[model samples]
Target: MTLSTQERTGPGDQAATGVVAIEATRLEKSFGNAAVLRGLDMKVRDGEVVAIFGANGAGKTTLLRILATLTRPDHGTVSIYGNDLAREAERARLSLGAVLHSPMLYGDMTVEENLKFFGRMFRVPGLSARVLEIADRMGLTPRLDQRVRELSHGYRKRAALARALLHRPRVLLLDEAETGLDEPARQVLDSVIAEHRAAGHAVVMTTHSVERGIAASDRVLVLAGGRFALDEPSSSVTLTDVTRFYIEPEPGDA
Candidate 1:
């Protein structure tokens, strides 16, 4: 589907109209004969939050990477905001904000400089104001002049997140977002997720903390063997259930 730039609505406007923010079907990936994702399928609607839970090497990061258009799937179709990710990568990128394992920030640059750079890259209007807004929201305003390499790990993560939100992306892809966050930082992350959902943006995250993941999401998906072993509404699953699934193999695993 080749949509003209004029036909595209702003990310926020698109979400309010209930558009599909992300769609993936029969996704498959492999590296040197080792299959990481096997026929995975997922859809995240605007105003929804989907959390994917998986163990190490469960292809969680790989899945996020593909969705963010950083990596291509061996077999599958992915669309962001109705644009084909593989074919219209540039267009799709305009609607995406991703925070993967790497902070994706310039270590030598100041926090404010990093945001300004990304804002310019995304062509975000009112770049200075937007950067300050996001920096304040992420609690990085006070340290805006500090070099990223000099900040603590938690602060660096915050800077990364601020950069992602600077353009008000329609879709957010987070990979273990809470990895180095402290309690307060986690609260800020939660608040950001809540705000995005309230504004009709979609979020897809991969996390190991069942409680935290499920708590922030509308749906929970357990990825095992490169496929969804369990997919259900977050309200229907408990922490105990997730723990059990992780601790005890669910029959038929070597």
Candidate 2:
């Protein structure tokens, strides 16, 4: 059963809210002759940063899409905050805010306009105030009227982040969120993620950079050749471990 609002009456999402924020079991997906995921079991608790790492075309995008409710899994059960993804799709979707590499915004619109539009889509109360809050928080107040396409990569990334945070989703799925970002852009992404983590939302991101992944994530998962391969806590694993795992696989490289 889903937790009641009474669970959140106290500070933070109250304990009455059972912890398993995101859960996937034996997930499988295939594209004709190619298989993207194979019996992968993944889980992320509330208020945590879990980063999934993978080489190019290692099914990371597929996994992110499935979890974000953007794509259907060929087989398996998934849940977000105690709500079933397949059985209660709308409920499950309401709990998630996703940012893929595409930014998922209208480039023709202004930064503030795009955020306001997304706020309206989520039916957020006080849409204008919320838009301004996000804009200010992301240092976008100066470029509020700038068209999204006219902005630099860094500002566009910030705009995308603002859109994701508009409704305060319980889970944030970031598929390659840090890709194509310069130093400053990457810093902004890191700071925004920190903000999300501090706000008690479960964040799951996919990245190619081990350093960035470890720095931003509480846990690291390596998906090799389209399977849920290596999973470990970020604090416990070092860059050496990441290098070794990538350069050389164990005896069970199946």
Candidate 3:
């Protein structure tokens, strides 16, 4: 079935639950036979917080890249808000707010300047108002005069988040979003996610901290060997399940 035929515009529920924001099926990605992803499948519902966890080189980043539309899969199909990524990239991308590991900011640009630049790119209405609003929420208005180079890691993250929201995307794709956050700063990120969740936005986050990931997510996915070895909900399962799956016994020693 195609994506556009699905209902993804409003905050609808999935069957008796919530509406799905992202639906990926038979996802496959390979780097010249490296086989980063193997028939991966995932479903994220609106207002749901999904966290992904895996060891290094486990295709976690590769899967996120496909979900963010930064990279494409060789074999599987992806759809966002029912729009096919391969067929209509623009329409599929318009509903996304992304924060990848890469920084797309200029060091010389002030916080406001950077926001305005991206605002223009999306032709976001009420640009100035939205900028100020997000700035205040992120505590960036005080650093409006500071260039991207002069800010600390936490503030820079806030600024980057502001830049992403310039277009008011329906879904948030965060890659290591809380890497540099302090206790208070991390709290803010939590607040941001909660606020967005309350506002009916879907979120897919990649995190290294298992505790934080479990606390923040409704569902958890562990991608290893280009496939999901474990897919379960945080509420019903314990960390022991993931540990048992990841930590295998010695080879032929038992």
Candidate number achieving the greatest TM-score relative to the actual structure: 1
Residues 103-154 of candidate 1 have per-residue lDDT tens digits of: 9999999999999999999999999989888888999999999999999999
- For residues 1-254, write the lDDT of model 3, one tens digit per residue: 11221322222343116666788888888776466777877777777777787766677777778877889899888888888888877887788888777556778999999999888888889999999998988888889889999989888888888887779898888888898877877887888887777787788888878878878877677766666676666665477655555532232211
Off by over 4 Å in 3: 1-16, 247-254
Write the residue-wise lDDT of candidate 2 on 101-182 in tens digits.
8888788999989998888878999999988888888788999999999998878877888898889888888887877777
- Candidate 1 clashing pairs? none
lDDT against the true structure, each candidate: 0.83, 0.77, 0.76
Predicted model with the maximum lDDT = 1
Q: What is the TM-score of each candidate against the true structure?
A: 0.89, 0.86, 0.88
Q: Pairing residues by index, what is the TM-score of model 1?
A: 0.89
Model 1 lDDT at residue 18: 68
In model 2, which runs have C-alpha deviations exceeding 4 angstroms?
1-18, 247-254
Candidate 1 weakest lDDT stretch, 10 residues: 1-10
The RMSD of every model to the true structure, in order and in angstroms, is 6.4, 6.3, 5.3
Error of 1 at 15 (Å): 10
